[model samples]
Target: MKTRRVFLQRAGISAVALAMPTLNPLLAMTKSADPLKNYAQTLRVAIMGLGSYGTRVAEAIQSCTRTKLVGVISGTPSKVVEWREKYGIPEKNCYNYENFDAIKDNPDIDAVYVITPNALHKDQVIRVAKAGKHAICEKPMAVNAADGQAMVDACKEAGVHLLIGYRMHFEPNTLEVVRMRKEGELGEIRFFQGLSGFVIGDPTQWRLDPELSGGGAMMDIGIYSINGARYMVGEEPIWVTAQEVKTDPVKFKEGVDETITFQLGFPSGAVASCLSTYNMNYLDRFYLNGSKGWAEMQPSTGYGPIKGTTHKGPLTEPIVTHQTVQMDEMAAIIFDGKEAEVPVNGAEGVKDMKIIDAIFKAIKTGGKVDLTFG
Candidate 1:
């Protein structure tokens, strides 16, 4: 196995291809055309963390006919001021961590997308919910299942929608594969393999910190494999067994996993083998084999034109930028009552977290851990 020295842990920013800039169909919206007249409704969003992924999403939202970036919530004054000048956000629409609660009174902002560190997601999303603004948070959703559930419950009580950032759930090629499986084109699913990882670069980065990151590679890139297995196999895992590997403990540190190999058994008798790591390269792949046919995506979960092939032929779905389609689809889901081909709601997020909790337990016990989802 090849090990790398650095990782792009930023959300929706790195995967495989510039990490390929996902190829997406450009919307009808243009600077010359008015979006209000073209689209039925619009979702005005404020991003909480001004990180690389947040900037990427903000850039994509510029082209969305139904989604608009109208505000920002950041702890750094420089980033806030930078976003204001660059995105043309108004002074009144700006907010910091301590004052974002005032958004409840500001009707102009429709939602807040929490892109903060892993451990911060629960509190930030709950606060966004309590403020009556819809909350869209980047995954895992939280550090653990309990925190994930708390965010979900808080949003439910606040009567606001809670959306987890599952960009691949809206990807064209991924959905094409899903459609094939759902329509019985893939036959009885039997196996799945997902490999996701990259090297860790800066040991001092927040991602390497136990408090902010909650964990290591598994908490970051590993999620792609876990989520992919469930969707590709069309079943949630009933049991999981995992083993951990650590190299250069000085960098990985305590509570931070270096690499992990895991197995998942589903109710349908299908099984999946997956690997998540922060110490390897040339990973990013997803494969599924069923009784009748099979599908494979090499650069599966990356940021591009996702490339894939199956027993039938190559997957040639219309390529759309990952973040662009995600934001547009999210707007439709929030405003037009449209359901996604794949779930991206809070419950979906919690299920992943529960499975992750089980994986960690299995690692500690060196035995299979059974999983049950509600």
Candidate 2:
């Protein structure tokens, strides 16, 4: 799959000189006093489109101490010789997808996660930020919001870091119910419901291809009820309204999508009632309400022991491995500039792709729509 003359022969130039712009030596290194002991002596990651959630993020980055899955970029050469003998890797840090921008001359790889197919995540995260590395991707980061803000302006004009898998922002009982609804204990908040779906089963995969899943089950499981109703109604929703219910229009063709129900409105007059489906089954749940009390989670965005309750009680919290604590808290928010209580960058994935473009423009203008995220 990788042949543009093996990416212009080891990227020896021109794809506009491997996308010009540069200068980001790990964002000029510095801040340390034990940046997790210098990011456990170097982060070193790599995996771009190996599929099955990139083998569950390379087995949860082997339970990441700091995060070190050496390298890989497969376009299937026997799945890159079966993940280079199951992750021993090396062979110039193995890559395909056309030489993967010569991994910018490989210094044993620093980052490049992308996991592919959400319309190829804005050109593989702008070619992993024009190959200067650091890019994480995944989630519904693109296929909208102008290709997720052109992959966050090509990783901020190539200074790097783009992150956005949003692994429930490092789940621990969903950040303890987003830190008990920001310590007010769900008090003045108003509403939220987010019931994400399931029940999809290969109607010819590539997620039922709307040109590789730009939409279907609301861009795959209704973007976990639109990013769990903006982190359980903490805010940011201006407006949106929608409805769609394709009972298999020949396997949800015409730009995909199947079963969607949305609403959002927030601005302290908070509101959200969502559902996204692919012919549901045990739909995951998340609920929040308040003027005084409420919170709930039932298999909420599963991929662990997430179960909950609130109005004070039963959250439990110690169930780890949501992609191994999101690659060890994204190696301390990319080498210790640390700051993700909830945001998972690329402008929090362009505010959930501008609320999935105002819920597909309020499902084609049946009304509501207005939204504005800064």
Candidate 3:
């Protein structure tokens, strides 16, 4: 399959060729003189779900330089009204799930950000693609690798972009660490330890439901460790071995994992030891070790102000809102055709899903599971 950047480049060439013959000399000259003028235009975005994370994302987008929250899609009528009034969304832009397909006719919306439950991502992303809009789906992207690939295919077929909401990919502290590792500051990377978890409050929440969440702590918080391992090591894992433990069987039922410790083996003989749990609090941290030096971050994946230190000194990157920077950078990706420093596309999401699939398989069989992204 052609990559998104290749597809965009090809499309851009064809578009330029098709428009050149019809362009008036004066208009062409004007366009050439200020090519960046139109590039600075705002990207109008519509948000789906309107849940807690969705609300946070909407608020964050308000701080974006080249993005606007112009529309909304929600199941509840009251939320639609509340969002419309608060965000200054028009009535025409507000839509229910059943009627959101009509967004194909609404030119005001450039993209739809799917911030709904994990299980709903596949269908909602495909629907967004079919509506002639770009898609920005929240992580974990989908319930499984197959679903994630389906969303990618749907967006590709529609000639639109599909971005996964990996906000940390745009985070300053995280990126600085990644940059250092890539610059060989970490030497030949050998090991990584990622501990990501949070205590669950409500047993009756949808996240506890296997059908809605796909899994338990692994699916929600554990994925951060999985993704961080991949990016921090800068390589695809060849195999995974995992073990699951549940202390509270009453709260975490069958198919819903409470705590999981997974290990990934890379082709370069590097290994990652990670833990994902729902019963633990303040477990967010990432540690990377290499032949020469090391880097560590505590409260790494938290909402804001991620702090870290390297073998040399402190990692002092400017702190910014993760979602806000993400939206601004996404505007560049969607409109200006800019490439992300760390990929956050559907393909990236699919790779993570593939790893997650392997981890689950490893846990189920109590053996090492070989991973193949293709």
Candidate 2 — what's its lDDT? Answer: 0.79
Models, CA RMSD each: 9.6, 18.1, 6.0
Judging by lDDT, tell me the better candidate of 2 and 3.
3
For candidate 3, the per-residue lDDT at 52 reads: 94
lDDT of each: 0.87, 0.79, 0.87
Models 1 onward score TM values of: 0.92, 0.34, 0.91
Where is model 1 poorest over a 10-residue stretch in terms of lDDT? 1-10
Candidate 1 residues 1-374, lDDT tens each? 01111211211122332232222334522444676444445788999999999999999888776789999999999999999999999999999999999998998998999999999999999999889888999988999999999999998787778999999998889988999999999899999999999987988899999899999999999999999999999998999999999988999999999999999999999999999999999899999999999999989998877899999888888777788788878876665445788899999999999989999999999999999997
Deviation of model 3 at 274, angstroms: 0.3
TM-score of 1: 0.92
Query: How accurate locally is residue 289 in candidate 2, as Cα lDDT from 0 to 100?
Result: 88
Model 1 per-residue lDDT at 74: 93
Any runs in candidate 1 off by more than 4 Å, and if so which?
A: 1-32
